[model samples]
Target: MLIMANNFFKPVGSKIFIINFYTFSKIENLIVWVNRSRYKNLDKIKYPAKAVIIDFSKCKPNIKPYHITPLACIIHEYQSKGYVIKLKNIPNNIECYLSSFNFQQFTENGSMIDIPVSSDCKILPLWLIKRNTYNLYPNRAKEYFENNHFDGLSLWPLSISLAELMNNIFDHSDSPIPGYTFTQYNATQDSIITCVCDFGVGIPVKVNNYLQTNNRGKLTNTGALLKAFEMNFSTKSQPHNKGYGLDNIISNIKLLNSKALIISNNVVYRIFPDNIEYTSELTVNFPGSLFVIWLNVNNLSVKEEEFADEAPL
Candidate 1:
């Protein structure tokens, strides 16, 4: 039986976020009320516990000023702990969202498959496919690249790197929740903005372990991230884990004059067309890793046949 340590409530802008679980047990009707919080983005804020409750009995069919992906990521974080997500009221759309991942009955009654929040954003399904959902990485990349008429080189890395990205989630992320992949084709920027996210054991832990074995001093999360881009560095113990996927992403990013950024734990690494850089100990520690790649297709012209020598994903 989990008991709240004390009565604690955080004033998130105008909203209230419970910090202490003292009242968590008394939350017969877990009502989640949100207003324009100081930071509309929940990820920017911090929480103290693993599981959260929501009572959507009165949630408007359409709720505005809500952040979907961030909330989803939070749920995934809790899921890793096998936390109980008690719900008093469940919405149909919300059920669909939760079902995208996996959930069993909580310590308290009620388990809804719907995702927490509902959004009108078309980017949801396209970007938030549950982990290991039919091995759709190849099809997803093809759809995005071909729809935009990107060069074949773009397809190669997109397909290969995306697969590697998903594989990393399975390989390193200890969470059972599937990783989520997001892609936004920004015509104005003339680039494919892609992000793969999961709330699991972040990159720093894996990289540091490898460092420990290789006699390298323990590295900060940032150091581990920066090192990950170099060729032949990997944390996988399997013989075939060549640690080649992300490096390939780097190679393609340069070939296309693009950019890639990987954020894990408290470190952030970026690779620009001209240089690669990293920053450590961000204001907040991300519960997991977020890998973002920008493929600038402004004037790409490489052909598919030209990428034959690339390794299999």
Candidate 2:
């Protein structure tokens, strides 16, 4: 449970500890781990240091977009603060997943990990995208899935959604950190999941800020997040920024009877065919935005003209 480090000659020396969260690897688990009393009291490892090792060997292998986005974002936040985060005892599949995206390149003492030859699922490796490169997402994403033989109709909506979501990162996040995007297709389940994450001022913060600046009453974090999805709702004042991106994403996903999850700060807004759900019960400590969409490959089709002129690919 405890790993030791030595600088025996110095009066004050650094220590190293292995962090093992003895629970299912959920985003909330990572949140609680990282946010627990400077990250010391959570594991009760006693000695605190600038560097730490996270042991993911015992974690479940069923990692999802929702989990990976927050995990990567949290690590990015820590690294930005000069913390040395090291990964150890990673499950092979998880290691391959992280390695496929060049994830280790950004971590301390991390190296390139080879993916297994037996892997069958298709992956669009996680990308760190900035304003200059965001426009490439839609086209690149389209090519990736199209080349992989996904249905054209399904991809149209996905492409449009990606364009809007990617644009939102640079236009709205207002953070220097590049946004993260990833996609994975599970052939066995006939489903695809794509996610976008950014460590910028969250949607709620931006909405409340716009409200305050305009001399309007502020809404709760959850309320502000809901207001964000309303058609024509936006914090941007530009004439062409129509604020239809989130609304359009919801609309497209509904057409396919798919699902989308949006998280800003502590609030979670879920869009599904049956109903809309919003909650603050999840212990998400992220200060930016995370969006994820799930669609079944078999359930995708385009109603003629809905996405005709907007198909960039």
Candidate 3:
């Protein structure tokens, strides 16, 4: 039986859990802390506990989407497992921001109240894409990009990257839950941050499983992740599935001098324009996967003809 630590969370009687700000101040802490809270005092709390309160009163005034998206993802994950989630002391603006994401759809009853969309809003609202309705993402995303002044060439890579990540949830992650995504564009920097997250069997597990089933041996979590980036590396058995998706993402990032952060299993991989870095030393393993990519909007210059490359000599 795991005990609820004083720093990360506080168990309120037998039903409610209070998650303090320290637990989610950083991405790493959020990922690990939530996992810890998930299994704590399982026997003490009744099935479908009353609520889990996230105390955000101590947070700063300005909260970005990156800060909220992962929190929302974890909250949704908990909700799926029968926990009622509630917010405590959320700043008015933060509450409004959450409303713009239409987070009311995930919460039951009046846990989250909706606020009208602000006229000056710049964010492309968060989307919940189910496997059966995954096809809707690209069209909506394209419209978002276009409305934000993203050129056709820029749309090529951005759309493909977003679509590919979404596709992986169904074709690779094998998750039953719906996927979540949202984009934040920085007009001054001419950059965009897109987050795609899902509750699924992570990449490493899927990759190693495929390898072991074929008697090809298993890989370390880090090794499996590295293998996932290589061209033609796929868990799929079909010959037509060449696994070009991740490879295209890597190439597009490099070409645009962009960056990406991928967290799956117990590992986090950082992809930069010049190099990639990864770490497997996570305090708690992620149950699924999250991808956050930063794209330099002005740097997208790939024409249709530039997409094809000649075979290496």
Candidate 4:
């Protein structure tokens, strides 16, 4: 009986034993059914369960396969001891976890699919130009040219034209409300159209102010624009070379093969290489100026045909 009980309760390798069970002869077969019943209950009790604790301070950002020292240690210890350890509260660092373990098994089981860093698109705002401020107009124009990759020859004419136009804005207009704006639109396969505008007193109004004091008071906006074209007619009351800038602008427009429109004092003066004409109406609501230039950068006409070929083939 003692041998049977010892075989049943000794747990194979356990040192636990009852001291009084050593003596007895027929005890081996006695209560054998009860011993079997008790052995079945003992089989339900699990031994050597384990818990793994993880520390999170050594994690790095934007790297995968996180190194979990504690969990790895627990796994090693439990495997050696013939037991299993369950890890809890895995850190939110995904790259760390993925790199440390073959997370493909977990991911294949429909675990974590939404990655944090993956995104669709990003947006940014457009830059603006301020007017009436000296030095800024040229700086902004240079910036525009640089951003668009315009060559020195292509940039120079426009820069000169803008400088002259802005000079007029400051020199002639009374209470000049200075502001500038530019908008670009794709026109065709080889063409881009851009419009630049400013909210300030117009040229015709400034010319009319000069004319009004010079006994030419009844002159209209069209008359002012035409008179501005004249070599000697100027808005400056002082003895200075006033109309030179306008004349230079007209000459530069012809040289560059560009067109311009000057709207002021309820009139529009369209200036082109072939014709200089005007229309009268209060179309401009505020006290400002607008200059629109269209450059056909991709057009064969502007690129190849516009320039003279060197000698022969």
Candidate 5:
């Protein structure tokens, strides 16, 4: 079906024709009737400079119909670029599918893809743990808290903790060597626990090398992990190392009110709410380091409570 504009007085003037596969005989009749009366002059109709074509023959039968508002906006944008658009061959099945599904139904029933989570509740391989990339973990956590009708503050600490852990994995680990593995699980009744394990050279070995050069001699990995938190104790000398990354992590642990355990070179440095303790027994079977963090998701109060009574005095 074609709707054409004719200008008899100026045959060479601009003309517009709108064509469609479906017939609009009644609409055409109405237009003819109007033309015979008020629109007797062909110049009365304003013609748009551009046209747009939408083809749907290759679209799936189950696919929803395309919305026209965005298409209209696109046409307006292209008109500014001095180009005309023509929409052609729209599939009948697409229209039918769209008509069958309402906006609410589409929003509610759409498939949400699954995201990978660890058994320890920590997302492994920080590179793979993105907010929107996999199941929207950040927003999902927010929505969960919202649905439970809790204050908004419960989710922010955990989010910051996760970001810090992931950032450490990326920045501290020496690449070219296979990186660390991350895992998470729920612990006790109110805590979410996560662990990051790296098989590369352990923290103790790095620290020992640094100390040895400074004439402090060889130190054990357990000693290294503990000393790693000491302000200004860094592997890089002079202006090369600011020695603040690990120290900052230790400081933030208090701010976040979290617990962490580092096992390296057969030694464990466990930091609880109050006391920081060290043990010589190396639980790690490999040459890398393992950091396990426990977050209290239920009661996320930044205020320092009395150190847990269980911490070694």
Candidate 6:
């Protein structure tokens, strides 16, 4: 079966493909076509299917992290859905790589993916955890820092980001820890990545609900996400509250020359170094939100400090 490139690259798709992933309707299973020579175009495979068919017949040279990360994420998505995945027309080089990777479903016995995560990427061990209160998260995430070997300076912004994320889950999401959080540092790439995923009310719904309660006009998912980065913008109504949480995350990214990708509903928003920005609305929607944070660790200049009082939230 031929999947047309034009089918995937709409206006929003050309800029940000993740938006298109959620918009694909009634996607019970996703069939992925990978052109090994054009590996960078994996973003075209935007939605999740009950089963994923990876036609890697064209791939000859083998794959790298850029390929691995998306492939792994897709594999994880499929496994989480208890779906069957098959890779066909693969070359010997790719097969050997998958063997060495110990990737499940590709092995001789069709086992599970067992790539040396600690080596390919620094990862958080806590894949799944529950949370009703805010206090437990940071403590539970201590393992993430310790295992990933993060420095105080690098940990600072992450600490604040996680807190606000937890608080958001508490205040608005009305959903606890039905989320997946991955924190990893790639030594060779000189970058640190933290991706947290949640299944909840999603950003658009939460934002519109608040607006409706306040008798304001309705805002689309794109507007709500754009507002999220604004300083003091919030949905919470509380005493002496200043919603600087999202703004704080944005600031730290600027201070450290980092990048951020925020996805909710059908919208995808990204902030890159030098203040580059990209936003797109999807046809489909992810229930809650996902935050992918990328920081240049070597360029970091934040001074390490001892917390005299407590955590940043």
Candidate 5 per-residue lDDT over residues 1-313, each given as its tens digit: 1234222122334455232222213323222222221211223345443432334443345321112211222233334344444544556655543333221222222122134322211222121332334234434543444334344444555444444444444444442232222323243335545455443456777678778878986766666777777876555533323444466556656655667766555566677865455465533233445566665565565333457769786
Our tally of clashes for model 1 stands at 12
Backbone collision count in every prediction?
12, 0, 0, 12, 17, 12
Give candidate 6 regions above 4 Å deviation: 1-121, 132-154, 174-177, 237-243, 302-313
What lDDT would each prediction earn against the true structure?
Answer: 0.53, 0.66, 0.68, 0.40, 0.43, 0.55
Ranking by lDDT: 3, 2, 6, 1, 5, 4
Candidate 3: segments with Cα more than 4 A from true spot: 1-6, 21-27, 37-48, 81-84, 104-121, 151-153, 237-243, 275-280, 302-313
Judged by whole-model lDDT over C-alpha atoms, candidate 6 comes out at: 0.55
Ranking the candidates on TM-score from highest down gives: 3, 2, 1, 6, 4, 5
Tens digits of per-residue lDDT for model 2, 60-87: 7777766666565556555555668888
Assess candidate 5 and give its lDDT: 0.43
| Residues 119-233 of candidate 1: C-alpha lDDT, one tens digit per residue | 3222223244454352575466555456545535445666777767776777666644565665555566777767777666688877888789989899777767767767876
TM-score of 2: 0.75
Q: What is the lDDT of candidate 3?
A: 0.68
Which one is best on lDDT?
Answer: 3
Assess the local accuracy of residue 282 in candidate 3 as a C-alpha lDDT between 0 and 100: 70
Q: Which residue runs does candidate 1 get wrong by more than 4 Å?
A: 1-68, 76-131, 148-154, 213-216, 237-243, 276-278, 305-313
Where is the poorest 10-residue window by lDDT in model 3? Answer: 110-119
Task: Compute each candidate's TM-score over C-alphas.
Answer: 0.59, 0.75, 0.80, 0.43, 0.43, 0.58
Q: lDDT per residue, candidate 4, 1-313, as tens digits?
A: 4454545333434322111111112212212312332211223334222322222233334321111211222233333333333223345665343433343232222112221111111100111232324445444554454355443324445555556655565566543233332323233422223333443456677777777787777566677766776765567633334446666666655555555655454555566534454455553232344454443343212222345566667
Give me the displacement of residue 175 in model 2, in angstroms.
3.0
User: What's the residue-level lDDT of 100 in candidate 2?
Assistant: 65
